[model samples]
Target: MIADPEGTVLALFAAFCRIGACIMVLPGFSSFRVPVQIRLFIAVAVSMALLPVMWDSIYPRVQGGGSNYLLLVGVEMLIGVTMGLIARYIVLAMQFAGTGISMAIGFNAAPGGGLLEAEPEGHITAFISFTVLFVLFLSDFHHMVIAALVRSYSFMPVGADFDPRMALMTLTDTLAGAFMLALRLASPFLVYGLIFNLSIGMVNKLSPQIPVYFISIPFILFGGLILLYFGSQSFFTLFVNGFEPLYLGLP
Candidate 1:
């Protein structure tokens, strides 16, 4: 019943090239803990599901089947990778902010295994990273990603010439936006640490005999914990709210 089996397969593969490449580097789905087989299956499943929706756009492009076809695949993968990297960079920025928060709150205990990664991370940093990621999942971040993928064809159609300059600028904007979001998230703790340390310093100067710095550790840590307890809800809310703007803004 199929009019052209070869063309159908080519179109499917073309779809997979973009979808699979994106999944290969996407945040939670691309984590080290996720098995390669699982990721592959997910990419294939998503590609197949989306193929029909994209058939008209993809099939026409691949019907030619020549050297140009190979170039199309390469460009598709590059665009996919760029899209995935934008999301990845935003998550990395959150980790960066977590590190800052841990340092600011005097929570610099010895690093342990990261909750989501192979690298070691301080307790507070790990907590923030995991919680932020968890909240993102709860908010259906994957759905957002799928929608973006569906829309991507409109923004960068099949077989179109790759624009490295535009891709680089988009990535640059992502980094700038992500870091600014990180800074805002960590700013409260930074200010808290500054004021607490300065006040402790003044006390130390007034009473030079006492071990003020050592004694103030518990006070600072306790205060930071209290601050964290009160502000955590707002912190996460801001992060979740910020994710959409940053992601949807991407090209």
Candidate 2:
């Protein structure tokens, strides 16, 4: 028979508070296309599976069952959300770089619906975002997140006070790191665009009679496309390589 069913239940919910909140904002799991019910079930299932493994850590903390328990719940959720945001911020940085690439290369075509998000995105942005997401899944990034979740209790145990300042600093660092990685990925295209535009401007100055701006558009667009096609492999490789460092570096 079960002993102290109430304590067990509390522990399970406590575990869910962390895991569920993380999944709620996690990149692929939090996509608009995923149903809320599916997310809920996935969270609950993972919580249950982990409960046994974490029993020693979680059950003792919640056995008291008082106002203190409420504080733990809130802290757990906050930690979960913070961790999820770390990953979310990185993916967002990639999207920002994609937008930059689109602008730099003169691919300002009208945006269409995004593959993962509800918001409309330019074709180049959408493609880059989707591809990055795809590569992340292919490399089992979710596994890393789950592993990190399990290890979290060791450092951020239950009943510990949530430190907003530390969380803020961690997020700020994540943003800075993510921005640097995005800039690295987009640097080549940015340089290419600058050189291409400068050359075209010189050509226009030499022959003011011709409509240089209109004529140069096709060449720049073609060159940008060619550059993207050739460099796509390196671009994604670097992105995947950098992701682990940024994520693991979080405090």
**Candidate 2 residue lDDT tens string, 91-118:** 9999999999998899989999998899
Per-residue error for 234 in candidate 2, Å, reads 1.1
Best by TM-score: 2
List candidate 2 stretches off by more than 4 Å.
none
Best by lDDT: 2
What's the lDDT for candidate 1? 0.91
For model 1, the superposed segments whose C-alpha errors exceed 4 Å read none
> Residue 138 of model 2: what lDDT?
100
Question: Clashes in candidate 1: how many?
Answer: 0
TM-score for candidate 2 = 0.97
lDDT of 2: 0.93
CA lDDT scores, all candidates in order: 0.91, 0.93
How big is the positional error of residue 136 in model 1, measured in Å on the Cα after superposition? 0.9
151-226, model 1: which lDDT tens digit per residue?
9999799999999999998899999999999999999999999999999899888999989868988988898899
- Candidate 2, after superposition: displacement of residue 135 in Å? 0.8
